[model samples]
Target: MSERTAQLSVRDGRWTLYVALMGVPVSQWPEHHFGAGVVPTPSERSRALTGLGFVFTDGATWAWEEYPEQPDDDTSPVRLLASIRVRSRDGSWS
Candidate 1:
């Protein structure tokens, strides 16, 4: 029930990490199917997050803060995104 806005940049390409968890939807997969019950295993989870290079916002409100290489430094802009996580009805979270 909360919402905010933020942005993030990569490769120092004229962008700063100002984005926050803007639109992250709730857990798509149920806690039981989320990689092995509530959360994924250390190794199994690590491998999944190892190649994370995209931003995903699921239309949900999230906590966000901006440090900006400086305050309101309008010298760069970051690309923000929106992600969607559909909850399965088969009592499975995958």
Candidate 2:
């Protein structure tokens, strides 16, 4: 997998985009249900983006860049960043 690649998942009415590194758990919560099958179809990806209030063009690939290195004291190799919601007006999320 690419260093900049991430996975998308929905749980408890919130959608999240995060990178999964080796030896790291996808999510601490068992309900997160990580490692699900990939969404290979661009149409489906577009649909998911639309449903999540993100702009996505069909047949376009979603790209991300490598994250900057963390502080020296942060020794953990595992890193994760996620956007739990994109369209919620009130910041309400599950």
Candidate 3:
């Protein structure tokens, strides 16, 4: 058998984008140890949704949620949240 290493993937990139877009304020969560500032384009946002394993509900909405691997019980607080709400110049959220 060959050994395999766990390398970083697109999911990790998406998660990083998600945290930045949500304005989670890294200062408050130093444990994550993320530096401030991120500016992604509309295309980048769309790519992240798919990369992060989000389900596309419509043209503009994407969502992702799931329990951690190896849960201790049936009721572990679900790791869930909706992400990305794009708005056009006309002032409408897509």
TM-score of each: 0.20, 0.28, 0.26
What is the per-residue lDDT of model 3 for residues 12-54, given as tens digits with 9 covering 90 to 100?
3332443222234644321121233343444655554444433
True lDDT of residue 17, candidate 3: 43
Ranking by lDDT: 2, 3, 1
CA-only RMSD, every prediction:
13.0, 11.6, 15.0
lDDT of each residue in 19-49, candidate 1, tens digit only: 2342435332111112212323334322332
Which sections of candidate 2 miss by over 4 Å?
1-15, 18-43, 57-61, 68-70, 73-75, 78-94
Answer with 1 or 3, whichever has the higher TM-score: 3
Cα displacement (angstroms), candidate 1, residue 78, comes to 2.0
Model 2 error, position 73 (Å)? 5.0
lDDT (C-alpha, whole model) for all candidates: 0.30, 0.38, 0.35
For model 3, where is the 10-residue window of minimal lDDT? 1-10
**Better by lDDT, candidate 2 or 1:** 2
Best by lDDT: 2
By TM-score, the best candidate is 2
If ranked by TM-score, best first, what sequence of candidates would result? 2, 3, 1
